[model samples]
Target: MCSGGFAKCLGITLIPLAVVCVLCNILLFFPGGKVVESDHITDEVWYSGGIFGSGVLMIFPALVFLGLKNNDCCGCCGNESCGRRFAMLSSILFATVGLVGAGYSVIVSAVAIDHGPKCLALEDGKSVWTYPFNTNGYLTDSTMWSKCTEPVGVVSWHLALFSVILIMGLIQIALCAVQVINGLLGALCGDCCGCCGGVSMFSYALDS
Candidate 1:
C-alpha cells in the first residue's frame, strides 16, 4: 500500500508519546521513593531516570529517521515536503511516548501514594497508620505480614520505595532496549535526508 497520509498521522501522534513516556517513568518513581526511602532512594531514581530517559527518551527523537514524511503543505506557504512531516511526527510520537510512562507513573503514584504514610499522615489526629512494605516493595499494612509469621518479611517505607524503584527500573531497562533499536535505526539512517523523513529530524531542533 502507498505510505503517505498514514505516516503523517503517525508522525504527529507517536512522536509525542515517545517523549512523554520518559517523563512519566521519572514521575512514577519520585513520590513513592521520596516518601518511603527519602534520601536513600535518590541513587535508584537517578539511575533509572538516566537509563530510561537517556537510553530511551534521549534517542526517541531518532524515530523520524525510519518513517516517511508529510505530503500536505501547511501555513500560508504551499510548500510540500512529505518527508519533513514524517520526521516531525516521529519525534513527537517518541517524545509523547516517553512522557506517557511518566504520566502513568505520576497518576499511579498519586493514587497509590495516598495510602502511603506521608500522604495519609496529612489526615492527622487519628492513629498513626503504618503500612507494611513487602519484599516485593509494595505497600500494604504490617498486619498483613505478622499474620504470615514468615521470616525475612520486613516492611517499611524503604521496601515500598524500593518496590516503585524496581518497577521503574524494569521499565527503564525495557526502554533502553527500545532505544537501542532506535539508535541502530538512527545509525543506519543517520541524520541525513533530503528532508529527513520520520522523527530523527527533530534532533536538529533540540541541538538548536
Candidate 2:
C-alpha cells in the first residue's frame, strides 16, 4: 500500500548515499588522505582505512540491491516469475555484509584511538614524536611530519565517514527486513487467496 512518491523518494536517496561511500573510499586511497600529521609535531596517527574501505565495499552490494528493488521492471535480472525471491535473497545477504563491515570498522577505530601513539620524552630540550602502530604490531604508512603543522585531518573525516556508513548500514538492514516480511506475507496470502497474494506480494517486493 505504499505510495509511488514514497518509493521514488527512497530510491533517489539511496543513489547519493552509495555515491558518497564510493567517494570516501576513493579519497582514502591517496597519500596523506587517510592519515595526516599535526602541524606542531612530526607524529603521524593512523586511521581505520582498511576497515572503512572494507565496510564501504561491503555496503556497495546493498546499494545494488536497493537499485534493483527500485527498478520499474519486474526484476533487474529480467526474470518476472522469480524476481521477487531473487531480490529478497540479495537484500538479505548484502545487508548482512554491510552491517558486519560497519560494526568492525567502528570497533577497529575505537581500538586505534585507545592505543594511539604518544609523544616520547624530550631529548636535549626537544620533544620527540612517535609513530602509531596497528593491531598487527607493525608500523603503518603514517610517519612523523617534518614540516607540516596542521592538525590531523584523518581523525575528523574518518570518524564522520564511518558514522555515516554505520547509519546507512542500519537503514539498509531495516529495509531488507521489511522486504523479507512483505515477501513472506505475500507468499502466505497467495497460497490461501490464489492470484491476489502473488500479485500484491510481487508488487510490494518491487516497490519496497
Candidate 3:
C-alpha cells in the first residue's frame, strides 16, 4: 500500500521531467544550440544526427511515464487482469527506454564535458565563446572571439541543458524501477489486499 503511494509520487515527479526533456529537444533544433559547430562537412552530419537522436530518445520514457500516471488506477479498463498486464508491459517498456536514454545522456554529458570546449576553436586562432542557446545575443556578433584559455570554467548553455537531461534521465530511471515493482505486485496479487501482501514481501526482500 505504501509502495503504491510512493509509486504514485514518483509518477507525478515525471511530469516535470517530461517538460524539461521537451524543452531541451526544442532548444537543440535551433542554430548554434548544439555543442558542436555545424560548419564542418563530415562532423556536421554526425553531430546533427546524434543530437536529434538523443533528443528523441530522451522524450520517449517521459511520455511513457506520463501515460502511466494517467492510467494509475486499476479497473479503469473494466478488467483487472487486462489492466495489470497493461501496466506490466508499460513498465517494462518504460524501464528499457529509460535505461537507454539515461545511458545516452550520461555518455553525451561526458563527451560534452570532455570535448565541447575544444570544438569552439576557429581557424584563425580565435575561439567562439557562445552558450548553448545564446540567449544573450553573444553569438549574433561576429567579433565575440577570445583566447580559449581566458574562458576556463565558464558554463555554456549546452552544458546546462545536458546537466538537466542527466538529472531527468536518472529520475526517469528511478521512477521506472518503482513502476516495475508496482506492476509486479499487481500481477502477483489477485485482489486489492493481495497487493498489500506483495508490497510487504517486496519490502521484506529489500530489507533482507
Q: Whose lDDT is higher: candidate 2's or candidate 3's?
A: 3
Please give the lDDT score for candidate 2: 0.43
> Against the true structure, what is each candidate's TM-score?
0.31, 0.45, 0.55
**lDDT sort, best first:** 3, 2, 1
> 96, model 1: CA deviation in Å?
18
What is the lDDT of every predicted structure here?
Answer: 0.40, 0.43, 0.50
Residue lDDT tens for model 1, 28-86: 34544343344323233444443353335434433442343322335115434433443
The segments of candidate 3 whose C-alpha lies over 4 angstroms from its true place after superposition are 1-8, 25-37, 40-82, 118-146, 149-155, 190-208
lDDT of 2 by residue, 75-96 (tens): 5467643554444444445545
Model 2 residue runs over 4 Å out of place are 1-15, 21-59, 70-81, 112-125, 131-208
State the displacement of the C-alpha of residue 108, model 3, in Å, after optimal TM-score superposition. Answer: 1.4
CA displacement after TM-score superposition, residue 196 of candidate 1 (Å) = 23
Instruction: Give per-residue CA lDDT, model 3, range 137-201, as digits (tens).
Output: 33343243232232332335445555566666667666666666665654465224265678788
